[model samples]
Target: MESSCPSTPRWNLDRPFLTGRFHQEIKGTSRFASDAKGCPLDSFSSGLENPIGCYDGAVQELIVIDDLLFALVGIEGRYISIKRVHGKADVFSFQVDASMDLALQEIAKRIFPLCESFLLIDEFVESGSQFKNGLVNHALAAALWALLLDYQAMVAQLEHQFRLRRLSIQGLWFCYQPMMGSMQALSTVIKKVSANNYAGSAVLNLLQSQAKAMAGDCAVRSLLEKMTHSASIAYLSILERVISWFILWI
Candidate 1:
């Protein structure tokens, strides 16, 4: 019998969001030289397993795409504030608010690419942030916020459609479970990431706790694997289990 369970989902986000040609072009490039020089952290290299050369590699990479995302966040946040400020302007409020809304909508287009960059860094960067706990936290927070914002938008859209009699309640719930499962999976990893100090003992404890938390949930098993595989470089072996049990449960 052909198994319904899929093979592990490779970080296939590279092709769509990250161009192989561009990735090749950027490799060995010194475009990020100044930012890399600005970082004074010691190099972390343990054989081929964990190798971040004599600068803050994450900062170097962040200079490329991460800074852009941060700028987008600031732009969007500023426009949001502007919209609120003009909310009380009675005379010209309508025109001002309309303009602000349009600007905010334009900025909203960048969110998906920002989310994609955070999700698919494994493809562009050879090694994940094993030695850089700060990098891990920054990525986690960005990814988590993006996931939450997406979930909220989805729920709001579904509810609006349901109120308009465009979707059945049953259908709404069915569509919602996957989103719920994805958020739950994200929360589980955030718990692991939130360990006060990223020590070996902390990682082990997180591994045990996550195993228990996910014991019977087949829906999120694969999603959880993807999240941890991408984000948890140091604990990849411990965190990403074979999904045979997930297959069986389903």
Candidate 2:
């Protein structure tokens, strides 16, 4: 999506949040929402109206992926047919609407970190457990696949946009910063995947290769600390929405 203001910066792979239409679709007719027992849909959506939280240091950062997985598993179970959910979440439906290419990408981004985090510390998603096997591993693999597809599209768009003319130094930084942030997110997941010897190695490797191929000689080698600074506030808002959907879907 293009920014209305010419001076406003645009990100290559901006994060996703629910559009009003998506929220309406799910809340109105989704079997997942209706079948979810005791878990009120409001728990997820209440914050969407005005999402803001202050940090008082009550919550300590999780030191290990196992801890995160433990938290993830604590969600109450309902028998989700993995095949059915996968069919629903496949590439065609991910866009939410014609204009929102990044919608599913953002969801995948939020999910991959959790997936890698869990896989890294547990060392493997035990094949026998329903939660790990059906929800975590299966869902993670699906999300990564969707993300890889989106990333490839982004590479093509970026190549075409930048090929005709070189941007000014400031313009270049604005353009590349979001690209680097996306790479950092991918790199973190890849490291965890490599460490764990996870099942989705093929997908991860392909994603890494695509990123490398797309980056070429551009200065994407170094991590930029402030790459996401401008979007942090909006990121938090999107994150609040993601958490809501996570509870609803899981």
Candidate 3:
């Protein structure tokens, strides 16, 4: 009886996959079998005695998937480093399925904006004396920073899972897709506030409104509520001071 599965082709492992130099070489000829010892597929027919070949093949696929995930999240990994050019948005160093590539691009689009928003706020807090001097702005900035820290932690957790080989590219995408809408909304609000030069209570009020609008998302709502509470501390203190002064006057 013949096996229904197609035979595994021999591949020359002399060149690195990261450089993409092996693509044409693999496609052009079966010359890969010339160096039989270097081929990953050589042991596939060797049966149970050579399990290492199976491991090697699996590792190769994992490496490619891991590299793609790292690129999607704009992180540097062992195999790939994502780069951005001024004229071009993001240039992927490796090629994959066109549909998968497009999906990763869309994920990157949603992610980088939030990253940029966090950087924008950090820069404002760091460089602008006026922003730093205001108590309300300071509190609001701290709250926003806290929220972004949680977001960063979530990404880090995903990276950890990938490293452990517990997550696949599809799993990573599925996990991230649900949160993209809430994150993008936060990014938009932050950018608008930054662009308009909104400060203090104005910023806090907008965030509160945004949080209310996102109430259906429990995780987002909880994060936003915590941020709002932190931001409102200064406002609440001022209100308390006024009430105490009015009581004394009465």
Candidate 4:
């Protein structure tokens, strides 16, 4: 509730962020973002191409909603609905007859679920009261949703492994990587948010529990390392560890 170190500069969401949990945004990596030559693995022979695969259709719809969010952000709730409806003037459909917005629909749908305030293990730690408020606001029902989703995905992968199917574990990587980073930032935020109170202790307990669900920092790193086979775990930064803790949270 009280700002202990208000002077401590927080990230400015108005502009692009270079580091922190928003690193991917800084690099302009969107769901539709492509490789050097422009081939999103989405359309490849991978299972991602399926509109019905693992709720792929739903994911695309969410991506569209995410874009819609940027338009609605910072608008006051008072008359905001009218403002949004009126704000539709500037909206224009990209009429590219090429291979243009083909992926737009899908990407937009994918990011829809994440548009709301997402909690990583650390994002909450930064703003203790706000985080707790969000938790209470959401009714604590989806507390383990992210972790459960990952658990299910991992289980699916294990199933595929057992069936001798060549399914990629990274199919769901996009869903978790940023989630992990965001959670870490939240953890740091929680410490600052709580300052000196029982909120801090409660948050620590919650965070530790979340970390356990995420398989802790070591297990997370191990899993990612094994899957990507990358010696450099770029997403394993401090913010990422906070996220891992959250996913581990039960």
Give the candidate number with the greatest lDDT: 3
Candidate 2 error regions (>4 Å): 1-135, 166-173, 198-250
Estimate, for each residue in 106-165, the C-alpha lDDT of model 2 and write its tens digit.
332343333323322222222212232323344444444454455446434544544553
Better of 2 and 3 by lDDT: 3
Model 1 stretches astray by more than 4 angstroms:
1-133, 168-171, 178-182, 188-216, 233-250
- Ranked by lDDT, the better of candidates 1 and 3 is 3
Q: Model 4 misses residue 107 by how many Å?
A: 2.0
Residues 39-148 of candidate 3 have per-residue lDDT tens digits of 23222222323322234434644654565455443343342322222232111222222222334434434444433344344443332223333567667667665655
* Of 2 and 4, the candidate ranking higher by TM-score: 4
Ranking by TM-score: 3, 1, 4, 2
Q: Name the candidate that leads on TM-score.
A: 3
lDDT score, residue 12, model 2? Answer: 15
TM-score per candidate, chains pooled: 0.31, 0.24, 0.53, 0.25
lDDT of each: 0.35, 0.31, 0.51, 0.33
Q: Runs in model 3 with CA error above 4 Å?
A: 1-133, 215-219, 245-250
Q: Each candidate: RMSD to true structure?
A: 19.8, 23.3, 18.3, 17.2
Off by over 4 Å in 4: 1-103, 118-198, 216-250
Q: How far is candidate 3 from the true structure (C-alpha RMSD, Å)?
A: 18.3
Rate residue 123 of model 3 by lDDT. Answer: 40
- Single out the weakest 10-residue window by summed lDDT for candidate 1: 89-98
How many Å off is the CA of 110 in candidate 3? 6.6
